[model samples]
Target: MSLRADLRVLWRSPGFRRLTWTRLLSQGGDGMFQVGIATAFFFDPTTATSPEQIAVGFAVLLAPFTLVGPFVGPLIDRWQRQRILLVGNLVRLVLAAGIITLVLADAPVWSLYATALLTLSVNRFLLAAMTAGLPQVVPAHQLLAANAVLPTLGTIAASVGGAIGGIATFVVPSVSDNSLAVTALICAGLAFGASSIAATRISRKELGPTHPLEKLDVGAQLRALTAELLEGERYLRARRTPWHALGVMSAQRLLYGLVFVASILASRSILADPDDAEAALGAFSIVLGFAAVGFGLAAVITPMLGDRVSRERWILICLGIGAVGQIVLATAPTAWALLTAAIIVSFAVQGGKIAVDTIVQRDTEDHVRGRAFTLYDMAYNVAFMSSAVVGGLILPDSGWSRPIMLGIAVVYVLVAIVFARTPHEVRPVPPRPVAN
Candidate 1:
């Protein structure tokens, strides 16, 4: 393709712009949800410290993603992805309202947890739809560049939401209940607006030959669902690729889980500003956001470098950078030092998204993209889930010390080793440029 054609095909495309705007809204809301919930759980007067209660509340939100994997993946493949995205975002309006009202009413904590989980589940599913939709929107040639830019935008939105949410928790009155409610409502409103804008701009014509769904037996469908739920693991067990990638991603997330638990403990123990826990939490994110700024810069550069580097090369480089950064995070002596390390870690870690995602997009087929990407999503989530469950058992007794950090570091190194040894069969091959 000529340079002019490439530019018009990607940059001038209406579908591309719509995808960008909607992603910003969705991820911004994600940052709002996390901050809102943390406020309710950590700072809200009505929250209790019962260990079981904390587990249950957090699990309830995460559970829907785990359980819904089977149905959601098949649905993304079987439906018009944009339609699903529009409907899903619009519906969150009600889900957000419900949680906000319950928080205000001081409803049973279980109700609040359940509502948050449902809203988040819906959010997770729509996110999957969007991921699966991208390749369909852009020509295969532009996949790498599109993947890099969209995710960078989402990171930016998340940082904005987190910072704003943190500040909102402090500034808003009647915030004991209404603060999160207001945040949720804004998120939902933006979601609806985003979906509508996308509807106007994106032509349904480019979506490729629509594969209509066929009916299946109830028992057979159940069996298929069970298989799909375990499909990612099965894929790994049967193949050489995904499991290695999974190991890398899982170890990284396990470290992240430890980081979260450790940061919480470190704020109280090491920093001794137990009362300023909020700032410590904010500090962690602020530093990470600054790092995301670096990722955003890379996003801009990746397109220019697109012809120069293979996507797989970028993945290997990013993973190495991330693993080393995690080591710095584990050993950093002070909160400010950790924050500085965080800036570095964030840049290294985020580059993984575009690289990893491009690999999946190029490697997986359109027919199976939904299942493939959803399973990847599940792998990433289940990694965190497993880490949380296992770490929860270990961290409380261990007191957020080196035991957790070093262990996670070792896991990351192992992941790096395995991925390094992984063969090229499944790795993405960069597209060849056309001579003018």
Candidate 2:
């Protein structure tokens, strides 16, 4: 009954409906685009590429965030948020379609890098705009609920889209000839759909002033963004609690990447059969979807429990769960054992991520949030990228997978120690005046 009531309340909210629906379509498109591109890559005549090449392709797609991210956050503060979103979606539609064209034409692989970069850079910009706008649209009371639900939905989309994408590659033998083109068209269609829905439903009149595009002298804007991003740096340092929280979370990301290395390498070594490979990845994806939805729900519920306990306490507990799960995988002796461990790890890690998102959202301010979160995103990407770089050098048939997984567990524990020392309260409230 309570869930129904919550649903009714959510359903009745015009802003929530528009925001969720738009995000659903757009984010689904984002997920599908990821899937489609991977498929295209496999079919590209340049299949002889390096193992890290695929990683590089995806990394290039995400790398722009680090370069322009600091600026993006401030831009979110300066512009009318919806307009920024509108422009981003439209530009992406073109880029997605263009990528498809180049792929089908069998254009040089060098070309794909630029397309990926453009698509993701615009995505980062739009993502910043959306993050700043969400608080404005939802009732303050439901903010946490809203945040939890959307990411939940997005994660589910990612899992499903990945599955669908893999299947598309398997089933569509002819898809390779124009796989990139097909990916582009589908992405464009999704973008167009999302744009139409948002344009019709979003309340343009309600938008608050942000730094307008014309005033965004790119150079000066970059400087201002740097300043704003720095504002939070002092806050991060002064309040050891939040810094501790960020540290654990950052370490979690690093270990999380390591865990992936452990799993992929384990699977290849232990169950290298062609038939088992697909089954393994598929099983992981399906379980991940379930895990994603569970975590998403937990995130919404977490805020309800927010007043009762410290975020650090929650993170500490979750990290411990995660560390144990990591150990389980590292030491698992068989494929089934590894699968069991993977499921538990997925549950723990995904749940922890949900809480982290909520923590960051609640802790940070809108004005500097884009820069802050973008840096947050950068830290996340960098950790994983660094792990991959290490893997290429250190990875060998001799199997260092267990050692790596154990290392991840150690990183998590060390991070938790730092978090445990952090004070219980650190949500940046303004300084109060002394009573005279």
Best of the candidates, lDDT: 1
How many residue pairs of model 2 clash at the backbone?
A: 7
* Runs with alpha carbons beyond 4 Å of true place in candidate 2: 1-9, 39-61, 139-141, 162-176, 179-184, 205-216, 239-242, 272-308, 393-400, 427-436
Candidate 1 lDDT, 1-436, residue by residue in tens: 3333444557677777777777787777777667766645532324423333334444655668977776667667666777676677767766777776776787997897777787788878877888888887787879877777777778778767766765665666653545646665555556545654665455553442257354535565555655554554454434445445555555666566555544544444455444554554455445455566657656765566667777656656666676665677667556665565555555555566666777677766565567766777777777666655665566652234555566666666666676777774664333222211
RMSD of 2: 4.9
Query: Per-residue lDDT of 1-436 in model 2, one digit per residue for the tens?
Result: 2333455676687776776766666766676677655433322324303335434543554467666666666666566777776767887887877877776788897897788676777766766566657666666566555555666665666555555555555565463566634743564457546764585578763443333454556776666666666666666556445455556666777666655554454444554432344443444344344445446546555555555655667777778877787687677546655666565666566556656665666666555455556666667667766665555455543233567667767777877787777676765556322211
In terms of lDDT, model 1 sits at 0.62
Go through the candidates in order and give each one's C-alpha lDDT. Answer: 0.62, 0.60
Best by TM-score: 2
lDDT of 1 at 214: 47
